[model samples]
Target: MTLTRRTLLLGLGAVTLSACADTAPVSSLATTGLPADLRPTPNAAYDAWVASFRSRAEGQGISQSTLNAAFRGTGYLPGVVRRDRNQTEFTRTLEDYLAITASDERISKGRAAFDRHRSTLNAVEARYGVPANIVTAIWGLESFYGERRGDVPVISATSTLAFDGRRGAFFERQLVEALRILQSGDVTPANMTGSWAGAMGHTQFIPTSYQTFAVDFTGDGRRDIWSDDPSDSLASTAAYLSRNGWQSGQSWGREAEDGALQPQPGGPRFAVTRNFRVIKTYNNSDSYAIGVGHLADRIAGGGPLRGSFPPDQFGLTKDDRIELQRRLTARGFDTGGADGVIGNNTRAAITAYQTNEGLAATGDPSPELLRRLGG
Candidate 1:
């Protein structure tokens, strides 16, 4: 259940295999090695999947009409599983990931979204005791303020994942909950598109999360987190955090001033509160948690990073820095075998390179030094 790279890959593989299974004819089921680009259309695949779900949902107390209405014509979305599979590659570096998701463009857009939905956000804040900016920042980070709410069919994605048998039981529960969402009239399946992993809405609630925390802030008798009105989604996120122990007054963490402190030796210094650790439970990466926490702070009007980051040692790009470690190891420089992470061995390699070249020995990788290494 830990959200590691291996788990992510397993989830994606499930999605790729299962999304259109119900729609595919029994005759075609025997066909092996289908092209990656092949997919079931909304018309052909949607009803069959819905029919199978409807029977089970009705047995579980979901109304027949509700299931019928919700699941009509939903399709497997293009590029959703592919995108999920490639998420790590896209955000390979913390700096690059932050530059995109926490960029001026996203921040400015988030502020505008905040202003536009101030009333709802404020109401949720008042009710939940969670700040509006934190809620909005989660919204921005999860789905770009609902502008990119994903196009993958939640039922299809979850069902596919569940049947794939990798993490079958976990995803099976999520699949059931997704059907329940439809039966409850919260959202139509066609409109229930989300990440390939089945996380949905502005705040990216998976089906189990939706069952636990989704709210009905609009008072329409439905926990409509997927709609254009962000009230429910925002409220749901606040509820989630509150239930998981989000502190009202504490900060997540702050950037350390010291560049000499490597994550390998001392790890990134973080003055983390209990709530900050709770945020990491959402996605178990320190860099991801830091990015969300920092972005949340910026959205709440905090200033830029207060520390100086030492330039990468060796004349190396981020990728080059990692590659240099690999090349150095090949040349018996013992740069600690490339891990795409800079550490003591890589630092020592840079120091040795500097010593040999009669350059200032800072033990950091710089672009100039990388060129000398033919990087």
Candidate 2:
């Protein structure tokens, strides 16, 4: 699991409802056919929760009607809370995760989207001094260029998480901010649907993120991140990077041919401007940062594999290495388990095979070795 924003939201919805219903009294609202564990609580607990949240919203200048309109009848969403709890364990290895998410399909679609919205993206770039490709890359990665911006109600999702008490304080603050957004007339309840964790719009912004960085690029009297128009979303992302110290004209790191480059003794060899660190704030993973950076580079017309990777000790392409592992296993060599990644087990197996064949026991799988093993 890559633990994208969608997964996080769904998990939050599940856990919140489960916790809320478990703590309710016997005479609480009956949840007969619901997922056994998740049920709505008695109106009293819910009402109390709403009242407390309402007071905070009111303190922030939100009116009573806004609170009522947003929270009335909004039950705890089990799926969203479950996602929030499970985010840590769901991430895949960085290479595999990035390969799937930033596949050629996504890249092709992203290019088309960029072309379609070039004027707005360019205008945003010019105004904010952030590159258009980086903005489009974030949009593509966050919500597949806005094609899948989620369907959960933002207020309901945030409120459920807050009441669930897992990360209660954090969610509570978001809930208050969400209500303030509604009160500010920026977006209505119906239009504020998003990930179950309460990240809304094309770029999946939490309510506070919207308050801090959203822009009304089209001057439509509303900062409409949910609209089909990409202007506001692109501008908002640019503003985020700019405020966080985006460099005016610098490259995010580039991919180098294997062994053609090496990291400096103390740091990464690739050049990462200040804006690159800003991207890391969105998701704190170097692989994620690099994938986004490289994808952005490609979208800007850079060629693939600028240099050749050093030959694997197996003397094979990555795909060929996997095939070697499979063939060695079929020959009863037990090259550990077939995982494509070269490891010590596979090297030992190759050494054993070389010894059996009266060849040099270099432990490196060359073409001659593959031929001898009937690969």
Model 1 over residues 126-239: C-alpha lDDT tens digits?
888778887888788777888877555676566555544456677667767777777777876556766667777777778877888888888999998777888888998888
Clashes of 2: 20
| Regions of model 1 farther than 4 Å from truth | 1-38, 41-59, 62-93, 256-268, 313-375
Off by more than 4 A, model 2: 1-44, 256-269, 306-375
Question: Taking the tens digit of each residue's C-alpha lDDT, what string does model 2 give over 1-375?
Answer: 223223233322211222222233322322243443244444456457866766666887878677666654456666565666767654444434445456677788888998999999899989988889988888888889999776566766777788878878877877887887878788877567676678888888877788888889999888889888878888988998888778878766565333222322222235555666767766655666766776776677765444333444445655676678888888878886665555679889888777877878888876666666674
Predicted structure with the largest lDDT when compared to the true one: 2
Candidate 1 total steric clashes = 12
Model 2 worst lDDT run, 10 consecutive residues: 12-21
